[model samples]
Target chain A: MSLAPDEVRNIAHLARLAIGDEDVPAHADNLSRILELVDQMQQVDTKGVEPMAHPLEGGQRLRPDEVIEEDQREAFQKLAPQTEVGLYLVPKVIE
Target chain B: MFEHTVAELSRLLADGEVTSEALTREYLDRIERLDSRFNSFVTVTGEPALEAARAADAERRAGRAGPLTGIPMAHKDIFCTRGVRTACGSKMLDSFVSPYDAGVVERLQSAGMVMLGKLNMDEFAMGSSNETSFYGPVANPWDEKAIPGGSSGGSAAALAARLTPAATGTDTGGSIRQPAAMCGVTGIKPTYGRVSRWGMVAFASSLDQGGPMARTAEDCAILLGAMAGFDERDSTSVQREVPDYTVGLGQSLEGLRIGLPREYFAEGLDDAVARVIDEAVAEYKRLGAEIKEISLPNTHLAVPAYYVVAPAEASSNLSRFDGVRYGHRCEDPQDLEDLYKRSRGEGFGDEVKRRIMIGTYALSAGYFDAYYLKAQQIRRLIADDFARAFEEVDVIMGPTAPNVAFDRGEKKDDPVAMYLSDIYTLSVNLAGLPGMSVPAGFKGDRPVGLQIIGNYFDEGRLLNVAHQFQQATDWHTRAPENIA
Candidate 1:
């Protein structure tokens, strides 16, 4: 179950990484080796074994829905790379 | 005084043998003399430390000081400390000053421990060695040429160099223990949910655990006492009562069944590491502990499983950093896509970006079942292996790493080799169990660690065992003569 170079390139694209064409072979090789290592999982009979998302099992712990404190957006936003008043600045999404 | 444990310092402070100001000054002076070489601290807060010291003195004068009062400690940069620049070791959060305190920071402050500064770590706590830190690598106190094991490398180095009596560290995959082992210090990653993760910058949610790093197991136990508790803020915070970790330190180890996993010693282990761990087990036998060989057949799958699960979680957790409400944003965005791309590309390091991509791919729609689902099942088998072993033994022991701390660039180019260094440590996190590293002996000039694996919330026993070992051996007490 080795990963193909194109598969690695596709995964890289999905991950939003700008991998160069030259680096594709190395990344493909590494990813394929990792996938090969993971191939060992197929030998285990996990058909009846339920997938464990987290180690602990219980109802989701929730806090009070109501706000217990005031907003610190003004102060926090000052640390952001770009912000204006309360709005976070980004490149315009639409024309 | 510089070599004294946190427990010793606290006692002297309470008895008026030393003032908080003097203690702070001593530590500050040591940090000043040594930090240049160690590179342990990213930001050393002089004004804040002195102010807290004075307040600690006043608190003592008012007879309101707790055990940790007036004692100095530092935080790993991952904790969002109020008014402090809590950079999670990336250029992204380099200028970000946290508006609020992490739950651990708040709790430690309540205990009256003075904040020294923020220690260095792997960028976003992603790497095993602290080299990935944006600020630079933290040097091992034992030998400046060698790395202090990381992502809590700075904390471990600082403690070893006597920069601070103790410091806080987070372990995802042996981050705390590896560095502790390399620097010849003691640190423990408590059972998951033992310490609140609120205000902690999430790396891998299921694996990230905050714990104590210090000069001794006793110091670690005391710090853990203050750090572990229920917090409504952290959803994963356990509702179980926090035990006094120091209560059973004096308990005997007679009749204790110590399990040595056969798989851990099977292959790829260095001779020096194997020898030191064998010596540690012999000492345990001398302490009346019964030793037996156990098998965790699923151990090899841990690293691969962790790579999948951790990256998947990291990819999701880091999605919040997309030119967001705080942290690095693109200078000028031609479009929203450009903003995200440049911001992330510019902000994160090569390794962090690599992990994010790996995680993103693993969790992508078509591959999710084959990659993420399969990893989760393997994660269960890894955990179940521990469950079966624990039923037969009180605790497990193994070499913390396959080899001693390597040269700076030894495994940097080889990501697989670097990943394999964590083979022994990853299974513990996969199983969500508690583990600690105590200084066993040296491999050449570099220090080796004897890892003790405990059942859930068995921190007290683990600490006691390490403490007992420290008492019997001087390895924990030995410091590099060149330091300070």
Candidate 2:
């Protein structure tokens, strides 16, 4: 299916990405191609086939809830783009 | 010395013929002198490598040298290396030094392997050509104008150029195998869950698997021994005892049943590449193996299903890189939404953004059933295709890629054309089975790879099969002449 520029903008918005007006045509072209590529799935008859989430079909391995990790916030925050006093500093969401 | 395999370097160290420090220094010098042409490494940890080599030598003096002691290799930049930049070949993480080591790095480091440094890769392991790498595209050592197939291109290039004896590579749909084929090296992507994914940056979570890239199957076996194991940290990591991959190296392929899927040999395969693969199969037959023509009817659908599934997971995983906590940040964002959108917009490349948007669209309301669920159903068919093929044969044999490495920038603009490059290798990842590419022969000056696919957790058997082939042929030993 061909994607309109507005549809492409909607997707970028939903994906939290910013596509410039000039880049929309390129995004529309590539995304449409990819969709076209994956559209081959429509030819296959998957009647009654369950969605395969895992390659091995094994369920997620579980462990008891416990503290397996130490508090390394300071060490981890060292790479943060903006952190202040052990807290990540992001743009305010509310006034 | 630079051309020596990992196993050879280990032997040299064991025989007291050379010190680890000397070997490391020799490799460092080569990287310093020659790597400029290939652009294989993003960071060369010369000082740390020398320090580790000295420590390895001291261990030898204390009679505690391990089998892998003093052997030097590189980690694909995708694997987090504590205190070192694990850029994953993107400008996003170019300045981010991981505070913790990836599971693969921890294992290799504990095995007494001296790390040369982090190798370059396609940004976030997204592209087929390594051109997506913010550091720059890695040059195929065979021909400077050609690409080393990616997203593990840097790892393959380093091994082919003899800049490093071995390197760690993660294959989420042929990243390990394709690059190995293009660069004339050997690489294996173990069954999904056979290797821990913890600390290895996520691509397609279900498809991503870490494996070894080396000069020979034997070296890959040795490194695989260290790299594969159940890690509790990775919820998806299988709980299974690791096998000694080398123990089966000398086993005869006499009675081995090799399957050639009819679908793999259909259209799109280059004539020259198919001819080499046919020769490799003939070699296996000569080694007492039997070949069967089987059908993986859903093979045509694999690339499409993969494009859907991989991107879906990648979109979710990459959402973690919103510029606040770490990685690339946009300067002076107007507000939270702007921070989220612009940081991601500026940080990611076109391929990555395209995938994220596609994934988001597929997963969005009203489209989920048509796209994501439909893709998953096709995924089952693809996996079942492999399952049936495996039942008829011990392993599947085919060309690692449709063609040899194309010239750099040839398909850089065409996303679909680039995606087709991994068609042969993608299904294995889809099935979460073990796969490897061994040096089969050359197409002109470029190498063609013989892809070997094994059933789940049958990595040792696959390595043994590759080992038998290497023993019979000198193809894997043929190094790039300029580097050699």
lDDT of 2 by residue, B156-192 (tens): 9999999999899999999999999999999999999
Question: For residues A1-95, could you state the per-residue lDDT of candidate 2 as single tens digits?
Answer: 89999999999999999878999999999999999998988877888999998887767777789988899999999989888888899888888
lDDT tens readout by residue for model 1, B200-249: 99999999999999988989999999999999989888898888888988
Best by TM-score: 2
Docking class of 1: medium
What TM-score number comes out for model 1?
0.97
Error of 2 at B25 (Å): 0.3
Distance from true position, residue B188, model 2, in Å? 0.4
CAPRI verdict on model 2? high
